[model samples]
Target: MAVQPVWHFNRSALAAIALSTLQSGLAQAITLMAPRQMGKSEFLQYDLLPHAEEHGWRVRYFGCATVSPRALTRRLQEALSDFAAGEKWLMRQFARLAGQHAATARAAFPERLVQELAQLRNEKKPSLLVIDDVDRVLQLAGGDTLLREILRAFAGTNGQARLVLSSTLTGHHQGLPALLQQQTTVLTLPDIGDAFVHHLVGQYHQLTRTKREDDNPFGKLSPYQGITWGQVDEGIMQDAFNRLQRIPYYFRALVEDLVLNPERAPAEALQVQLARLQRHRVAVLSWEEMSRLDRLLLTEVAKGTRQFYGDTLRQYLAAQTGAARVSTSQVQSSLKKLMRNRVLGQEADGRYLIIDPHLAAALSVTDKA
Candidate 1:
């Protein structure tokens, strides 16, 4: 069987470089922030992790969406214990000092796990903990504090370990901005461009042999016969560039949609699919998915109150909901939910804004009426 091709992007190269250049004693973390479905996780998993392992680093990857912080901490403890056991001298030393089994050492709490990993350092080799979809992790109760503790532990470890946090640019997680500001190096993924689109489209055509041919009745070539970039129509490629907005995931979706429905005209099919997506977005979650207070909070956000101080938002929600007053905690809970849903995003200046333009536009139309 032939080896499958992996789509390489400029951002993937940059991420690998960033990981390779991390100084051990710097007490720094790297943040890869991008929009959802933009391949941040895939880049970290398929590209960055392999690169780190090849350079002799022990990598522990946690998908934060599926794993809670407490569970992740326990896993880290076990990994550290196993790492220590692999080194006979260190295991013996630990055994002599504690007079306990390795499993007992593995039972350390999250805080102590960090300390242990931090202290287990070799100049030639280091450990890496990659937390993907960190925004979801922050959604869990006490997640921000847990993450801060983990990062702090690594920072104090004298170059023993490093952390890579992958998250979307949207959402407001308490203390995350401060944690990022303190010592993390931030990397943003740029939009995909025409050159990448051309390469990708050409690759798809060649792989699927979808070019028009005179010999076949349907005017499609055999799968074994590859197509060149020039053979693909420039107009269709341009339409793809415009329609997909240089997002690789969107492009792939469009291509898959076209492949699955070969009888439909490519451009028409793409437009139809995009329209369906817009309709789904409009219908999926509106007033039904949110509480009255949540809708009021979002309405206020949509009305151009770019920043919502806790008290201000609480007051607005209370007034809109016809309650005498609202508590700050209630307002905060609603805001976090909105942020998590990607309906609202926090700016660098700590102001909240609606990040999804389509949803914002739909809401604005409804408000105007």
Candidate 2:
């Protein structure tokens, strides 16, 4: 099937890379690690979900950011409901089969879903399971101990059942995917190459229907244009693509928004959008309203200590700030607050540091960068 090749940058290629994995019966798991706006989740919803259905598999999708690991059991039941949609043919057949054995229908699919040996023999089609935003849930729920429990029940059934799981982080955490990594096929997401980004700009331009502009984003996307045609030199294209790679999504958005406004320079628009994102990331932190105890914790973190663990690190905050030493539970609560604020990074070793060096310099939110 032809891909729509959305201008989200690297998504169609990523989809191509992912869909190709289905050719192998061996489970090929992947994590797309490109920039935030590269449309990793969109690729799954658009490309993988429907395409996997062609193999006669019923795809089950749940997101960790949308639902916690502790909620996996209930959420899986809900996905079964979506699978058993009123208009669905498979569900119709399930219901028809149920009429003959009314007692077992409700529990049967789920029971068989957990154990593939029985399902493989009696099932009419294949099945796929998807869990998205696993990293967020792992961060929130303390790893995917609960989520892995559900997945472990379905292990070693790749031929009859396959799974597609997504998380934002690249490395293993105390997360669901990490626990299951030994059995999974891991794929890392690649960023957009300098060679074809003009193609990305062109794709978005077609979506916009704008022909020309002042300091145009689309027309002068040098890297894409350079390798693309005789219109621009390769050196100039490479130079431009290199300098602006950090903000391709910003460029796309600028082009799209400015297409109608013609008066805007795409570069200036890009600056505006990136600044807006940083501000938004920062503003989301304000809702926390850090208590005096919380501020004390932050004050300790600015001092920098390796032995200072997550909540333990925060303990130094209150004690050193001349405030009450935060209670064990309060310190734990403060740790979560800092993590959610994106102002601190917690290593697998249990140490919490500022997000990254560059972001530390940005002095806004602590990004994993």
Candidate 3:
């Protein structure tokens, strides 16, 4: 089957809102919070970056979740050099018009690379930095110190530069919100909406369209052969989107399956995707990392345990771990680990919720067993 082009749902308005919030001086940095595979990365690259540039702001993007401190620092320095060199033309014009000499211009630059990069922006042109998976970076050894340095760099008086950080629930569990409450604005990326579903339906229909002379009326027969693509429309697409929990990645996967295998119903494709997700490498690795107590906590959270440190849960943990006793601190520590790993999130009501849908589905199977 031929590969279909990527379908993008325009989110310029959301990008505008975020940029406006930054321009209004409400916050120096904005952290967009969402679950994994919900299209945060795509939005940053396709939507936010372009909008910032169109508005005359220089934009730099970095995904530093898995990199070492030295590597991350190197990448940032490279970005700084590239952007600074690109803007040197403008700086030169300013120097000529102001009649400033080379020595004074060089001396005016900030000591740090990041701060120097920020100095490139002025009232007419600002800079925006989009950093993804900031939660993981903050959890790295000495990560907190590095992050504080970056924050301080942006805080300088040199022309304004805005920071946009992205994180999952793990960041919240690790106290990201409270830690940066005074300086950061938190935004939730909304789910894929009706427009996206509508687009998928249209694309599927276009792909499945058959020629009149074809022996097979639908041009090709799908393996499942239970439903024809003719039956798919916006309503069916909306149903599939909801069933997939409005996760863009899974929904797109289901549509791709239908495009490749036209006989499969949307419902069947959804089931296939969910099954595949249950065995996903990340999910499997996370499950392996859990201790016995951590596994119990996961199942208990799936069962809606609000009082994780209570006597009943402590007794259960003690019995399960075969220990003489389980202290409240011990249970608390386990829960914190789960949160840090992005397995669970706590609500304002003190209820624990599974942050990963794949893990939650796996837990549901365990519940039935």
Candidate 4:
């Protein structure tokens, strides 16, 4: 199989390795969390799923953000039914039964899936189910209950079926039932580091030195046209590492900008592109996605009111909203949510700081408005 080209391997590869190693352990579920645009989805699609399939594990991927619970359940049942039947004749037989007893299929799909999974185990086969954007699933009505039941059905598979849940580090995960949470091993993707940056720059340089052909892996661009590897000095690479903050998305953008503006030096081109990206990220990327209360709390932190007790925030909120009073519990709850989302970091002294400085600048603008 032809594998897709990936930019550079990061810590997410380590997380995938850990998941593979722990397959025989007590933990049956792994929860992976990363910030937006951090390549979590691509890592699972191009790397993890292929690895699992190579080891003879049947893989079912659920894009949780795009499907409802009913639709998800139906799709899962169809896939498992296909797996259980194997032959075309057997699949036709299962399809006939599904059409004849639609109501029964609705009620018994979970049980049937469990049975089929057991059959796979008997045949010395195992399965893996990956649900991406699991946080979106938890936000739906009765989603927690539905997820709990689905996981419960898989419990009897005795390690035949492994579950991997991927999502941004949103507060919605707090809604997961205790049983599910306890069984899950949480893996967080750290921010891009210097090593990956160095590796990526090296990869680009190698691609440039290779003969430019129609089948050039790095794309059709002539090496002579733009800021080739030769033009990017050590100082320029270090400047990119610092200015792009080593984030993959930002790094890619900077590289593209340099390619487009080859006349400019790498460091100068990167500075221009980085400023543009930072502005877009602060105004359009991060701030627009935050909740109202989260935005407010972050704005307060950006304004130098770092330490916020429950009562302190409640009073501040009351004054800002023109409400007669606000509850301390509400303030505390928002703080916890913001912390989970990684928008705010709490120190040992209980003071909170806006985790991203660019976001702080955006919040300050909003505060003044």
lDDT leader: 3
- Model 2, global lDDT: 0.51
lDDT of 4 by residue, 49-119 (tens): 77777778767676766676667655545644555544342654566676866676667766765666566
lDDT of each: 0.63, 0.51, 0.70, 0.64
Candidate achieving higher TM-score, 3 or 4: 3
The predicted structure with the larger lDDT, 1 or 4, is: 4
For 47-90, candidate 2 gives per-residue lDDT tens digits of 67666666456666666566655675555544543443412536
Clashes of each: 1, 5, 0, 0
In model 4, which residue pairs have backbone atoms overlapping below 3 Å? Answer: none
For 1-369, candidate 3 gives per-residue lDDT tens digits of 112236766688888998888878877888887777888877887888888888888787787765676576545444544454445747655764677765654453335445565555644678788888787666667666656766767777353778898887442343345645555778888876778898877777666664222526565753434555466778777887876667788888888887777667677888998766655514323666679988888888777667777788789889999999999888888888877765676767677777775467557668879
Model 4 TM-score (2 dp): 0.66
Candidate 4 lDDT for residue 95: 66
Task: Kindly list the per-residue Cα lDDT of model 1 for residues 1-369, writing each as its tens digit.
Answer: 112245554345665676766754433688887765667777787777777776788776777666555686545444444443334436646674676665655454456655566556644678777878776656667767766766777677666677788776542233246666565777776665676666666656654553444336765555434423343355686676565544566667676655554555566756775665454443335546778987777767667775555676677667778999888677788889877775667777777766644455456766888
RMSD of each: 7.4, 8.3, 7.1, 7.1
Winner by lDDT between candidate 3 and candidate 2: 3
**Model 3 Cα shift for residue 38 (angstroms):** 0.8
Ranking by TM-score: 3, 4, 1, 2
Off by over 4 Å in 2: 1-13, 19-25, 28-35, 50-73, 80-112, 115-126, 136-146, 156-158, 170-177, 180-183, 204-248, 280-337, 340-342, 353-369
Q: Write down the TM-score of every candidate.
A: 0.65, 0.59, 0.71, 0.66
